[model samples]
Target: MATNITWHPNLTYQERSELINQKGATIWLTGLSASGKSTIACALEQLLLKEKVTAYRLDGDNIRFGLNKDLGFSEKDRVENIRRIAEVSKLFADSCSIAVTSFISPYREDRDKARELHLNSNLKFIEVFVDVPLEVAEKRDPKGLYKKAREGVIKDFTGISAPYEAPIKPEIHIRTDLLSVEESALQIYNYLKEHNVL
Candidate 1:
């Protein structure tokens, strides 16, 4: 921690939303590898943008290339990565833009911490569990991560080596195998509409 550190107050969330005609929230998509988190997130962002809603995607691999470059897949590093993501998503929500985050955030504790951060800030934290069976995920492994994990080439892989703590009561539980990408995005969009996230 730094000495003499203090938070400078800025425009209120309501004020910003009034000016921008948009209220911000975070739709956090969590699941195992190949569970369609990123794909659904991408579709949701596109749909929101087309409807004139300000939205941005914070992809796991993309964030690792930049904002979280120093972080690795270790348990400690993963925790820190989520902490940073929570902070960044809060900033976006405060700026009156939806933060669509796609990550295989396997730990319940870390996800709960992120939810707490948004709750404290008076922002919406929509937990979307893109759930798929382990066998289904392995079959759909676009990155071959499941195969690598099975071969012992990848360590600490969720649903393979590491554990994925499924959400007990996620706001949205999407079954990608049952729904198309468009339908999945529509489901989230409908949730936002119903919850008055506009």
Candidate 2:
């Protein structure tokens, strides 16, 4: 005999939201490789921690080296990469955790698809565009990814061989070229404060 699945309604999101003293959300940072997305994300997480908030960061390099090791930079692989991260972010948000994900996520369609997976009123999926000119990003090649892509050593890289479509209207746009790391973090924190998420 097959066992029937049981249904159970445990704690409500409102209960959890009240307990945390804040709402659940995911900060999605999308930009070129050297556009300072990760830097700002890390800084923001530290600031949140100081304010007694729980924050988790998922960096592109860290994820690519592990969760997406088998994946290449092809369009399909890029979709899969962002899809996995989005699902993970949704899980974190559902658990009332602040999830910050830094990725290129070059395609608008792919990013929107990811957002659809967690289309909840409580889930504030903020898309932060780290705006840095291509020339500036190339100059700040901390990992030399730009040079490699230009030399054809790395194929399908965003903002180089591949395209990186900036968000038409991002929830937050941090101009990395103009703002210092601390300033960018403050901008993000102010946004969170304005939304009453922190």
Candidate 3:
């Protein structure tokens, strides 16, 4: 099945970047649920667009409604879900667009695989650790997921029934518990700018 595939592209990533006037990259935001990953990502997207940058967000829930609709919360399914998102993000990066992904990609191995994918492609992969205490996340419970998990309505939930392996040396670490949405987004935006990804 792989033998018949052929590469066909008229414009290179550099050309695309030249046309867009910005470099392409992937910003992988990982943390426990309600850790403000999505909130910060959305705000960052808006900021990037306001600066005339091409950016797109591949959020966890949004992907589940489409590309990952068939996947579930099982460990195996979760790995595949992140795998697919990482691949898609690479494609977006190859086209010179910023791919912002927000997911509770709890496993270190899984997140490492996504980083490897981007690194091998010569695309910037930023691992952002949206750090928030489990207690705080449960207290916030923006989606009521923590409540459901506590009631046994949901199983294999990260920071509850499942596990979340925090990044050892993330490119950026945002303590959402101590920062506002704008501040968190600005931290990420500053990272992209300092790294020449914007």
The per-model lDDT (C-alpha) reads: 0.94, 0.88, 0.92
Q: How do the residues 1-198 of candidate 2 rate in per-residue lDDT, one tens digit apiece? A: 458877687877679878877677899999888999999999999998898888899986678889889998788888899899999898788778789999989999888977777785447798999999999999989989899999999988888789988899899999999999999989999999998887
lDDT of 1 by residue, 80-118 (tens): 999999999999998989999999988999999999999
User: For residues 1-198, what per-residue lDDT tens digits would candidate 3 score against the true structure?
Assistant: 599889986987778878867788999999999999999999999999999888999997679999999999999999999999999999988888999999999999999999999999889999999999989998999889999999999999899899889999999999998999999999999988888787
Q: Pairing residues by index, what is the TM-score of model 2?
A: 0.91
Task: Kindly report which residue stretches of model 2 are placed more than 4 angstroms away from their true locations once superposed.
Answer: 1-9
TM-score of 1: 0.98
Candidate achieving the largest TM-score: 1
The 10-residue segment of model 1 with minimum total lDDT is 1-10
What TM-score do all the candidates reach, one by one?
0.98, 0.91, 0.96
Count backbone clashes in candidate 3.
0
Q: What is the lDDT of residue 98 in candidate 2?
A: 88
